[model samples]
Target: MLPSTSILFLCFLCCLSPIVPTSLNLTLPHQHPDPEAVVEKLQWKLNVSLSRRQMLGNDGKGTSSGSPSSFSCLTGNPIDDCWRCDPNWASNRQRLADCGIGFGHAAMGGKGGQIYIVTDSSDPDPANPKPGTLRFAVIQEQPLWIIFSGDMMIKLRYELIVNSYKTIDGRGANVHVTGGGCITLQYVSNVIIHNIHVHHCYPAGNTNIRSSPTHLGWRTKSDGDGISIFGARNIWIDHCSLSYCTDGLIDAIMGSTAITISNSHFSHHNEVMLLGHSDGYVLDEGMQVTIAFNRFGEKLVQRMPRCRRGYIHVVNNDFTYWEMYAIGGSANPTINSQGNRYIAPADVYAKEVTKRVDTDEKDWTNWNWRTEGDILVNGAFFVPSGEGLGVLYAKASSVEPKSAGLIQQLTLNAGVFGDPRDSVSVGFSGGTTTSGSSTSNNGGGDYFGMIFGGSAAPPPPSLTITTALLSLLVIIILNSRHPLLYYIHPLLKHST
Candidate 1:
């Protein structure tokens, strides 16, 4: 019998040795990364930090506790409140005060000793005084009109001209000004148009080209623009949605500055936002403008605001399915575009491999498309423009064939010629020109010269001929050393 210790040691050695396969092996398919995890990681890096207390609000002092009488009173000298001692104001004040202890005095001071009338749907007397119809009375110190209602709709027959300091408190209402040619604002300053929906006001038959431009032009007759701010300053257009218009959604034409357009949605129009028109008063340069956190939707084409030499800060906006270029700036306007998600058309990635070759017969010397760090993938070269050309599409094989041809054509078109007189003949083939040419070829001898002229020597023919051959080689290499090659052969034999 073998030694007992030796026998145990031999058994241990056998267990530790690698197992030799008696049959074929198998492998699994490639697994893609999780998209949700990618989105979550991106959000984690970009989410703005906010205090928990700020979101919930101060203990109890911030919100109304029920009694209108207990409502916090407003206090500002030369206040613009429309709620005061008017008979209409008293009735509206009492109705709200009866609700509870917190519903009385307006948080923003009420206007003193002026009657501002608001037509109520449930009032017995249409013209006479009614509770809540008075809403808030404005002190007539500075020519003001105030209207208040919750979800109220009002129709106007004539144009409403607001000349002085006017505040129309809709109390969050859908204010419809219909059959009126237009609402004109003349020499108005410090106008606050907040939380109101103004719509469906079309231009009249009068071709008053001075008052309205839509009547004169043949293509300008649709629902008309939502709001027109002419000769106004310190304007705020917030939390508003403008749509279904014939012209632009928001027209801030001529001499309107110090504008802040935040938290708004613009869609369904020819021109979404028009800053200054050619005919209007020339807006001065360096006007401060901020466009933040707005969603611009689909089917909108040519959405550019023409501002002359203004400072524009466009940040944190989502643009989807845009038909043409999203934003264009003229007059050397200072524009900063950051953190915007641009989704390309869907059909650009349907094919596995496509080859495109640019045979520039007309200008063989000008192969503009060939640039440094450009990669040719599966017989297709993907060249990007600007600094970010390769960062996003860095992979060697994923660029489309058509993109390569487009970049090459651009390169060739920008080349220089040997003869100064003949601009088309870029870069000399070691020849002297009639104009006493310098030996350095300073103008045409650089990279720019190569872009315009054909290569000094013809590139190896194998460079073009081997593209398809290389692709086949890659396929054969992958198949020969495949993880499950052993199993695949056996499986095929078994099936046969």
Candidate 2:
């Protein structure tokens, strides 16, 4: 008989042979030799050094410094004037004086505008305040929630730009803005709009009457964009929830830059965020915007904002059930999309490729090349052609004829449908020709319907088979090791 040690060694060698699982058919790409090591290296590179507050700071400090003046100090019945009658009012009278509409005047001094209090329902009347007027007032000890009862709408005639460092302190009461109108800001910086619920604004373009032509305009169609910012910079929109209107949830047209939108939830809108010009020209600089830590869900269709010649940084946003494109860019913009959690449907990959192809054919080679990183599970490639275009590659299955046909369609649709991805083909792909259209369509098309054909069929299950086999092989190797090869078994065998 073979010696015990030799027999055990031979058994170990037998167990060491490759064990493939029964369920697998197709070959899998080789597993990375050290996946954990690869992840470690990537984490080191992608780590962001700034803290959450530091990254989202308004005016260099991330925190809101003071309580809003609108609701600061108050007892019972501010409109009734009972709190002003107290005996100890002298010591706290300064706090009460500081409590009203112009509380920030000490800090603001003469540089900011005056403060006006709207005590009655008559204050917002266009006639009372008059048009092109600046009225500042404090409601005095009244909870800020009182401002929402259609009282603020009376001041519609005057352009109500909250200067003098105004704060509508809620003082534990909720202040909401309902009904729709434009709030215009001129030469205003270091502004903070916080802790307020603004909703049910009337749709834009519905009313025939007009406010100031240049500073403020009439309510037009409710495209669903809740708020409007005209020519404002260093603005921070945080901790707010907006719903139920028309167009985009937040529309930044014209040239508005250095804006940060963080820690908000958006849903039920067509275009959630829009950053571009209405006329489509390259301005001096586009909007420099950052979107982070927001949650999105169940969009009706593609709802990405268009960024033109701007810097957009999208990080750490969770997208649950994105029915259409989660994020998209346009114009000659720079977009950085990183650290996002996305749950996309199966056809997302095919749809994305088609969109890119369509975008490249438009705009006559004006599309800028930027970096894009996406994570997909069990996706496949269908190349319309077998070559890589500039920053664009046909999937593996695309033949030259099919690629050419698709390119031709893309060019024709360019004039009618603008590039949604805002890509223009500058150079030719290998064995491909460049084409153009006469008119501009602003990157709109039915490419998705064509690429997907009908309903989006589920992808094949080949990936599942490969994964099962790898797991089975690992299990087999671990279990097959010798029972008596280690220390406990060697002594017993030797005694026997």
Candidate 3:
């Protein structure tokens, strides 16, 4: 039999192993070293940014109509407000690599990649586009920071399949991806899409398409979501405008995790966003998404979003209007809604924002869904059901919920950065005018190159709770029978 110390050590590990979420598998990729650690880092960054803005003695208020030099560094828009208004923004391009918030805080996309300019707007050939086209930039084998040279609208003839390690920055141009196919990120990782307009995406597929510089595949009929993520991880989608999609504005599925969708606008669409694939798709249970600081505006229907069995953080966004409902779900997904302003439409029957689709109270009531500090306007109401407040709060993965009053300021600058070259008019759906702007080098990066770009390697594999526990069990059993197990002998010697 094993000695007392060996048995105790094994017991300790086994007891601790069950802390792993039920959705994880043995080969989970891009798992954080410690998610709590990432969250802590994000909190610290946010605090420092806010504190610095306070020290400057100027809030992100007034107007974006003035010259770029006079723009407010802190726009009161939580995402853009954090770093958009600094006059030195053009010189600090890589600061955006550090500006990621929520679950995708670690997704440093194309941080060390070479800058690739998309100078051509024509996509005369979908299968083989010109070297300077947007399609060409995304399919490159190496990491690339893609930027546009000027204002151009890309009417893609096919879905733009993107490869790994890319950042499509549309800050300096009036770039719009509309009137045709949209973006597809599948089986790739570490992608950042910022400051572009993706709207009116129509479906186009059932043809051969180049996914990368090396491989071309026959794609099925595509659902023209503004963005579609499948089997991908470490993604950050920020500061874009999405609307009028054939399908979901954005959708993540097939075990995709570690994502943050922040500081963007979505309007005039049905089925806005979808977090997981389906109820029976067990791999999605491992999905974790952060939906923060976005705007759901102007004639949107339901599923903003309809989730499956994943953990989602919906925080500090502006829901301007929802016709049927705002947030819906099935399969007992855990939704933590905090500090958002949900302005329901005048339709009395649709005032309720949360929908437990195909689920009765007896089932979904046991699901962990909580609403904290949310402002429900125009008779908007949220029906929450789940564990007690203490239990739910303890299990929540997000930062402390901020006040609902801050929603306007947090989401003030939703959508892509406005071009200083054009005049913009500010308006609001509810009762407040949000701060708006159209500039590229907002606060984080310089116009052309950011400092954080490097040939950064993907993060090392992390230990899951289940894996740790199983290893401990094997160690214990071996130690009990063969105390001199060769592999563990060193550990045993150290212990002794």
Candidate 4:
């Protein structure tokens, strides 16, 4: 054993460390607001917004179908049908703001913002984009709802750095971003990228690129991700077709949180989605992402996101094919796979959906990766890990699981739809709405749950917090009995 002096020195060093409070009882007087009351208020706010939209569409009439009076049967996919079938959908494109499901449900991308029309497809100068270009619309600091005037393939000279509060709406047009650098959302918030095709993104640049209207900085080589969410939050990417990117089609990294990638079709990609930056990046622990109602189809290999450390809610997506494992992660991410349809390839080697990258079985066994109500086809298997309990699984899941059979219907209209038609118009034969649609043709009540639903789990126990708290508590209890006791007493008092 070491001498008492050495023990005392070690204790002194421990005292210098920060003290973390336990169970935090962060609930001060009225701090612990009633959760139900908060939910009800939020529900009311959403209702009022929807009702106001209806009023505006109907010119004060009480018609739930908005204007034009012609109503189609609900598609049962609450998120897609919420605004897709509306006759005034083009006019009220902002209604998509209310359509997000999961952690990003609150991402009201450019809602209540002025509309900006992008008439130009050319990007001659990325640093100083013309007013009519997509780059210009995205760089503006103000909230903007951008719409393409016509179908066009935009080849970017550099990666498009999108600013906060921007919505790139690609409905009613076949907008393809290809053969160049794609979108990068760095340190921005509340961005919605919908109904666009993002493919063939090539790495470019070691030059100045304009991030915002005022700021232009030299950017290093960007990994050709179709969409890169870096240090950003509240991002909703919906109804986009992503394929053949140089890197991940969609990547959320560097503490990016509150994201939902839903109703998107991802195909012909190698590395698909990536969440968190690196294995050692503990800041990404706060990341919460929802991957829902997407089609992971055709020639996809691994990492339908390879998460690092985050709460990843993968639900209701149709994984039609994958050359390699579908979902992978390391650093103990909490992955909740629910009601998804995973169809493995005939390659016997790639039958499993889960991949614990470079981790030992003993270590990965404790990672929270759970599958609930998933339909695994073609010998597809998910190697579930962690505490396989209802509460633990519920904590990881963002929304309640629907029937696994509904996966086909949920992702039926997965990609960007050029035209709005009855579910049959999307090419499904004998298309029928879900049971809920029969009673609620008018999208009402619990609309938030349609896309981004479910409250997050309580905070996980922190090792640093626990260790420091125990050490500090001990030193305080043994005050003056130890040499290091007095050193941390002031810190203990401050913490308490």
After superposition, which runs of candidate 2 have C-alpha atoms over 4 Å from their true positions? 1-171, 182-187, 204-224, 298-300, 345-358, 361-496
Model 3 ranges with Cα > 4 A deviation: 1-27, 31-47, 58-71, 76-78, 388-405, 419-496
Candidate 1 lDDT over residue span 299-365, tens digit each? 5554534343344444334343344445543333333332332332233441111111222234222
lDDT of model 3, residue 486: 31
Give candidate 1 regions above 4 Å deviation: 1-117, 120-145, 154-160, 177-183, 205-223, 279-282, 304-306, 338-496
- Superposed by TM-score, candidate 4 places the C-alpha of residue 216 at a distance from the truth, in angstroms, of 1.1
Error of 2 at 7 (Å): 99
Q: Which of candidates 2 and 3 reaches a greater lDDT? A: 3
Leading candidate by lDDT: 4
**All candidates: TM-score:** 0.41, 0.44, 0.74, 0.74
> What range of 10 consecutive residues in model 3 has the weakest lDDT sum?
446-455
Tens digits of per-residue lDDT for model 4, 216-294: 8777677788988876888999999888999889988766787888888888889998998877555566677878788
Task: Give all candidates' CA lDDT scores.
Answer: 0.33, 0.34, 0.68, 0.69
lDDT of 3 by residue, 247-345 (tens): 889999866899999988888898999998777555565677888888887778888888987667776777887789989999877676655667767
Model 4 misplacement above 4 A: 1-15, 18-73, 389-405, 418-496
Of candidates 4 and 1, the better by TM-score: 4
Decide which is better by lDDT, 1 or 2.
Answer: 2
Q: Give one clash count per candidate, in the order shown.
A: 26, 43, 19, 5
